[model samples]
Target: MTYKNEQLSEEKVFKDPVHRYVHVRDRVIWDLIATPEFQRLRRIKQLGTTNLTFHGAEHSRFNHSLGVYEIVRRIINMFEDRPHWNKEERLLSLCAALLHDLGHGPFSHSFEKVFKLDHEQFTQRIIVGDTTINQILEKVSPGFSQKVADVIGKTYKDKLVVSLISSQIDADRMDYLIRDAYFTGVSYGHFDMERIMRVMRPIDDQVVIKSTGMHAVEDYIMSRYQMYWQVYFHPVTRSAEVILTKILHRAKELFEDGNYTFKLEPVHFISFFNGDVKLDEYLKLDESIVQYYFQLWQDEDDEILRDLSERFINRRLFKYVEFNPNLQMKEWMKLYKLFQYAGIDPEYYLVVDSSSDLPYDFYRPGEEGERLPIHLLMPDGSLKELSRHSDIVEAISGKKRTDHKLYFPKDRIEELEDKQLVKQIKQILYGQGEVENVR
Candidate 1:
């Protein structure tokens, strides 16, 4: 048998906490899992700094990727022989779902922001570059690796297949919601995924839910909204992320400084600091390596790098107060000046972080990050947008909410011998009446 069509003698099953079991049969799938690039995902946490906030959230992207593949597998089985579903596309869909998150690096979002890297771009490169994943995909077809990249990148010819992995209510989101909820020990991500999958119909170019399953989809949407605010954007987790980002920033800055000398070489970060990271260099970076660098930097001579690394490794997260950058320009300048006067580098110490989400949105042409809206298949066999059918979904549809906070090391501020300067900073952070109450 050819490699793509070959089957294992027995089904390999992975005991999954979220999906219970992830079954593998196709030799191609099995080989892909064993590849070094795929194995790298085990070292990258699914939630990044979220584990610091929710102690139970130590699950890795390896777990989430398997959950996504299993979900698509189940959906494909249900789609067998169904109208508008071509069985020829089954393997491609499964491959796409499995490899969707293959490119995320250590502390994904923070690393991306500081280095200006897109994990999706890296994912495509890995699939098409001279990697084990690329070799495995090429065994299936001459340009099969590119096909997988296009599917994950949302540039594939089959919109229906793409919808299964990249849609507003696709397998990727469905698996992560339930999986993250389970790992984080939260109820917000809970939703009846089975009902939604069962009622999903393959239309010409999209997957639409049967109107009978509208309530289930509604629950899914609300669950995503709640998960974003309550769990994904939890204040404590953001504080940890703030410290992590600052650590990266400090390390990169130090790397660029010719005068600075490190006790230990930052070999892993050289490419990232120079902004020309190659694929091999990127694949070598994972959570453990980043953590090791942080541990070493804790003893570095650069005080800011040492302090930020210490804060990250020891969980000395910055305290935050609600900040409106637009309305508080003068107060912000004064705060910056005050920190500098007290020997604190406001560049790293005072950070304004913002988080925002639009729970659900209808497509608006030419808008940035436009997403296809969910559709419901009515009993009359006509398609209607989800917001038109459910009041619960409509209420949050297209409404964007944002949060802004100024994060700083308040403990350091308190340690200042100049008590009067501390009071002034506190008054700026907290109003006059609230200043005395602060510890």
Candidate 2:
């Protein structure tokens, strides 16, 4: 038997809260899972700063990665005897699904934004570079490692495999939606995944749902919409993200100034501060390491660094007000100046954050990041794009929605020595009357 086809004497199963049991029968898949690089995902969060809002969202990327692998495994099993299904691609698909998120750093989104790094590129490196994962993939075949990386990058020639991992409704999204919802303890992520998966059929280069499963598909789309607004884009989560971003900014600035002294030197951050991080340095970072720095920086002499570190470590997130830069530029400037006058650094303390989503979209041939439209296979073998038949999906198809909020420290604003300035800020934020108790 080929290395890729080698199965264990007995199947191993991992009990998962979302998928019940994640089974591993292939020796290659099991070996990859045991690698140190793959194990590192246990230290990184699946949802950055979201746990601050939904306390139950403390699950790590390891959990979600395993869930994704299991979903792909089930999909491949169903496709085993079907026409146009390539059994040769089975191991490749499973390895790609399991290792897709291997390179995610601690608080992935915020870290990427602040450091100008791409986790996807790191993932490619871990797969193709000289690493344990690469070693195992090489055992399968000299070229197998590159194939798995190409699959995750969406550059693989097998359009069918690419669609399985990345299309509008694929294993990655399907797993994360349910897993995130389950861990976050929210009702929005629940949907008939089994029904949808059962109806999935591979036709041409894409996976299509049978016409009978249209309602389940509709429910899945609606569930995604609710989760985006309710859980993924929660205001409190954004507040924590804002503070986290500011903390990184302040630390980088202080490091470049060449005069500030850190109680614990950010050995892991120097390469990042210089804008060229080595893979080894990057791999050494996780949420625990980041928090360790935050804990020590709380005693730093720089007040901004110390204060921001304390806020993040202790969960003292910023308070936000609804403010649109397009409509409230003058008001935003007024607040910016007022904050500076009040001894709070406007650049660090005042922030505006925005979140946007395109609920669903049909294929736009030449568009960048174009999503392959979800199609339904009719009894007569005719295919129809989803939005054409589903009213709820049609209402949101191709529509982009965005929301913005202005964040500031409520404690600092309330304790200002100048009451008139505080009153003006409050009036602008909460109308022309006394500041009501708002949570």
Candidate 3:
């Protein structure tokens, strides 16, 4: 036994676009990745319905997990000889970073929003509870699993390990920002990742960027802001979300009404409808299962369910126009009334979508800010908050960008037999009636 923990006999490599290749040296990390539960991430899309908007965004959570792991591996390599960076915690940090998104379910965000599920809690359950992940984690040590969980939960005592995974400018963000940009074919996410990696240093339990790399950090922050508005919060994506939400609502209502019957109870949906879901059932539910049910519902007797499912699956997304939350109130009300008159349900067919995100935020004392602020290490060994050092971060700090749009079935309205009514609705929506008659 010549220090067997050094490396695996057969090195494992996951082909990844973001990091090029995810290399596994420790047997523990290799075993964890081989677990069946981890394999399930292959089928779960990282961006979910965003693929419908960005055709190239078909990458899975498996892709992201490996990318995160690779970034952590590189950062830890940089910290090997540095102060405050423990060699003991190396595997734990990589494990935590890799499995952070393991608990994400199918269409995670929309599903969680509609059903009140927290993926983070589910993540802990999968890691510490009885499952392949738990077993794999326990292989390292009984207490080891909890340490990995704690790092992801952001409750770990080691500030350095927690910061690497959960901090504002950590491996998770770094991987996603770059990976998402590459897959979506956008130029905004092209920050100098190599420079950022080189600038990282571990100092007394906190990781900070070297002041020389402030420009690289600024580019990363700006890139994140651009991606949020350009891709993550696109109005079209929100429109699909609205439709998915209404689909869930309709299914729940039909279940409650007790008049309609489903071919199957859709057991996975039962808990969500009843507002109590179990982790095992949630884990079993992936995008394929959801799409399977949607396909089945297409043949259901409920016209609303069938139609909406078809729309979602077929990319018949609602068209939208910029809406003013303040000035469009009356117009929105009139559009609601007109929808009813035109036999379209305003609740399902007409929607106003609003999305806002803060790309960067400064520390606000006693406020509800969750993420720790990014810090840059000055030459004299003192740390400066990122916004204070970088002009790009200063410009975007604490400024939340918001976008609003009113979504409607442009196809339906265009083809509406009642041309005059359609004209009026179009006038209210676009401020003029240039809409062509539904041919």
Model 3, range 258-295, lDDT digits (tens) per residue?
88889878888888788878777777888899999988
- Candidate number with greatest lDDT: 1
Q: Give the Å error, residue 78, model 2.
A: 0.6
Candidate 2 residue lDDT tens string, 72-150: 9999999999987888889888999999998898999899999998899999999998799999999999899999999
**For model 1, how does the per-residue alpha-carbon lDDT over 216-255 read when each residue is reduced to its tens digit?**
9989999999999999898889999988988898888877
Each model's lDDT: 0.92, 0.91, 0.85
| Candidate 3 worst ten-residue window by lDDT | 430-439
Candidate with more favorable, higher TM-score: 2 or 3:
2
Clashing pairs in 2: none
Q: What is the descending TM-score order?
A: 1, 2, 3
- Model 2 — which ten-residue stretch has the worst lDDT? 430-439
Model 1 root mean square deviation, Cα atoms: 2.3
Q: Return whichever of 1 and 2 wins on lDDT.
A: 1
Model 2 residue 404 CA deviation in Å: 0.4
Q: Candidate 1: where is the Cα deviation over 4 Å?
A: 433-439
